[model samples]
Target: MGRYACVVRPSISLVVPVFNEEENLAHAVAVAGRALAEFTSQYEVILVDDASTDRTPEIIRGLTATDPHIRTLRHDRNQKLGGTLRDGFAAASMDLVLYMDADLPFDPREIGRAISAMEVTRADMIAAYRYDRTGEGLRRAIYSYVYNGIIGVLFGWPHRDINFAFKLMRREILEAVELRSEGSLISAELITKTKNLGFTVQQIGLDYFPRTRGRSTLSSLGVIGKIFRELIVLYPEMRHPRRRSPQPAVRPAEDRAPI
Candidate 1:
């Protein structure tokens, strides 16, 4: 028998949140689909449109018309990153769920390696950090450094890139963790709660690719203020999350790799 003939590939739900990404949506989805096929045949690409005011809706319709594996959900109004991902996670019917941004921050081909890491380490969630981020610019780099430091101090997890939009997890983790943040803090909330609730999270390092086609407003002062306001309102709950229903036994997190 072959060395890997018995390995079972898990089904996946690739959740992508988009706003005004008409230029990148179609191409990104196509690339993701191809990459996903390299590992598993059973996968769905869920495109969550957060009330985009562009040709995004038309593009989604065209994609669904041609690809049966592609699915979409749209909001009546802008709900930001948290709400969009919440809906996508709810609609996902797979054993595993992976979240990526519309701009394609990392190579989709890396998806295979992440899955391999999860299987090898028996990790409940896989969080990816960039090997290098200097291409994104100085202001964002400073923001990332400070934000990561604060999260490390408060959460005590020492996660390298809490806000980076590259995370993969088993479906059960999302089912057990109730996420409430409606802004960028959602990522931090997800990672923090998972760590506190006794699930194993493993980190991987990947090459960073900054957005080249569209403008990124995630680093704007307005967004930063909203994240802070949310942090204040949701601090207590995040610090001490109420455990949901019991989950299956998880292995000790001692095997997790360093980023």
Candidate 2:
């Protein structure tokens, strides 16, 4: 029998959005290799360099050269985190998708956990929840409070971390919810929008860790202001059911033109 003739199993596409984090990229890749390879051999790891001004793009190129499974997409202009994710998601082609922070704050073992949960529950989405908060004092507390409170009140909680980066999702769910929030708060935007569509999703508690390098992009003033804006702007979509969820609707390169 040909290799393609066996019973087909769904595969994973791990999408890691990269900015200017040269220091942390290698560690993230290593963890992915250790944790994800056991699940499915037909998987792909997509690294997106969102027009990093630093060595991030170079680092990504190096990884791609050594690993055929590692695919990369680069943006010419510096798009923020959300834009990077949008670009990354568009390029992905797999049955299952995994998106996470490259800084190594969340546990990678949760990849196996999330996939297992999806298989058992047949849930469209599996989100990773932090059992304990990492990082330091007030910033950690404030971030948790702001996002958790907003998520609980605005959307339906019981899910503590709406913005948790580690998520395992089906291609249908990923395609259904069109991702657009082009900044740090895209996680909240994704969770709320997905819940509205009735995706049968669940959260699994996870181990959190401290970032040893690469400064966080979230600022005290910037984050808070953005939160309020999201509540006002993005909240209404949650109020009423949208006709359909976001999915991939791609066009030829020639079609995307100024003319």
Candidate 3:
């Protein structure tokens, strides 16, 4: 008698980094959860709370209590967006890992499209670009154009939306690259590193929506300056190639606060 082998379907881990987004948390999770469910039943949503001073933590506790697939990871102190993302990536446990903003600017359902693209083309990473970016001022627009241009010229990869929040990548790519940025520049760092490592990459378009509940945290001039400074420091590393390292172990959700 021949024995049958179990074929494992691809699973996904959705990482959402939350900071003082109490107003949007419940709705974001609901929408994103429904979107993920449409694609694969084997998935997990990891919410990383960066020590929000508001009622964000309490809201997360309430949401996680009802859903076993929803897990919460808390930072004792507030870390910036980059730190929160690093933790989220480390906590992800599925074959594919995706991270997006908590404000839900892009349609969550697009995640299914991204996963399909990844599978069809066998690409290692899928970078999302916004078609009509709403709710952004002229200053932000100019800054984004200039920043993306600089990255293109420096890295020789002309990806227009380097800082957009929707990124879906294979687990092996994350394991092979080393990420150091702990600010807004983390997005750029991840892309640059992936390109450097010769990973297959593809781009997809997403429709942007205006945020209704919370304001962006990285709009301050100080934050922008820090991102530029980090980019300057990362130039030398990007120019040189290093041996790919083994994938780091997925860190179990730390400070698993009782819901």
Candidate 4:
């Protein structure tokens, strides 16, 4: 930890949530280690195992034993992606927080770009955008329309790829927003909240990869139906001031602009 302090830029905490991703867990972790290695001189990787039912936890143990920068946190039972991310966020010890997928859907190397974007641009959050994606072609297309349209039109968030799990957030923004969704939609919620809070956001292009194993949780019709319901009922919860325990800390912006 001491050695990392000198070189790690803003102390990065990489939070990856896992649930039954044992097959790809090790690969994701390995890529994260390599990417973060080039990302900065110092950093810590936190693997949040959300009660995996396979060898995921065992693999995590092995990973921790070999890498000092890697550590594992376990959830007794399945907490779902949202819960896993919340747990990871709570356990993060770095000033800059990164949340990514355990399925290796995005290029880990883009992490360096995100870190650089934040440091150089003075932005509080960097959201990664995907050019081409995977999964059932129709389903991914539907997801794009639902998420991007809703957040852009209703919430007015300056976000392009709301479904992307890869994000770099400053500690201040992390502490400010209370993430409550136990599923994937929380990704969109975070973008909406940050924009509503008037935080500066930057989007960067990222490589999208196909998932070889395991299946996505939602179908095209299934996701569209769910998000629409969430749109009406969840807006309040997402923007809830009471939900964020201490409330979002303000940095006294020199000028407020539309997000």
Number of clashing pairs per prediction, in order: 0, 6, 0, 1
**Candidate 1 colliding pairs:** none
Which model scores highest in lDDT? 1
TM-scores of the models, in the order given: 0.92, 0.85, 0.89, 0.84
For residues 1-259, what per-residue lDDT tens digits would candidate 1 score against the true structure? 1232225677889999999998899999999998887776499999999999989999999999999999999998999888998899889888789999999999888888888888877888999999899998888899999999998998766889998888999877787788888988999988888877877899999888999987796888978888899999888888886666575443335542221
Q: Which regions of candidate 4 fall more than 4 Å away from where they truly are?
A: 1-8, 134-136, 218-230, 237-243, 247-259
Error of 2 at 222 (Å): 2.3
Question: What lDDT does candidate 3 reach at residue 249?
Answer: 50
- In model 2, the clashing pairs are 175-246, 175-247, 176-245, 176-246, 177-246, 178-246
Residue-wise C-alpha lDDT for candidate 3, range 1-259, written one tens digit per residue: 0121112235789999899998898999999888777666488999999999999998999999988889889999877878888888988888788888899988888877787677666678898998875458787788888889998998887998988888998776677778788888898888888888777789999898868888787879988988988888887886665435654553332321110
- The runs of at least 3 residues in candidate 1 whose Cα sits more than 4 Å from the true structure, single-residue gaps closed, are 1-6, 245-259
Ranking by lDDT: 1, 3, 4, 2
List, residue by residue over 1-259, the lDDT tens digit for candidate 2: 2222213235878898887889999889888866666666478989888788888988888888988889988889977767888787778888778888788777676666666677666677888877777455677767777768867776666567776678887766667676567676678777776777776678888887767899776555776676667567767775555634333453332352110
Runs of candidate 2 exceeding 4 Å displacement:
1-9, 244-259
Q: Which 10 consecutive positions of candidate 2 have the poorest summed lDDT? A: 1-10
User: How high is the CA lDDT of each candidate model?
Assistant: 0.85, 0.73, 0.80, 0.74
Off by over 4 Å in 3: 1-9, 243-259
What's the true lDDT of residue 120 in model 1?
79
Residue-by-residue lDDT tens digits, candidate 4, 49-168: 888788888888888988899878899987666678888888887767898888888877777667667766678898888877655487667768766876777664456788777889
Q: What's every prediction's RMSD, in angstroms?
A: 4.0, 7.4, 7.4, 4.9
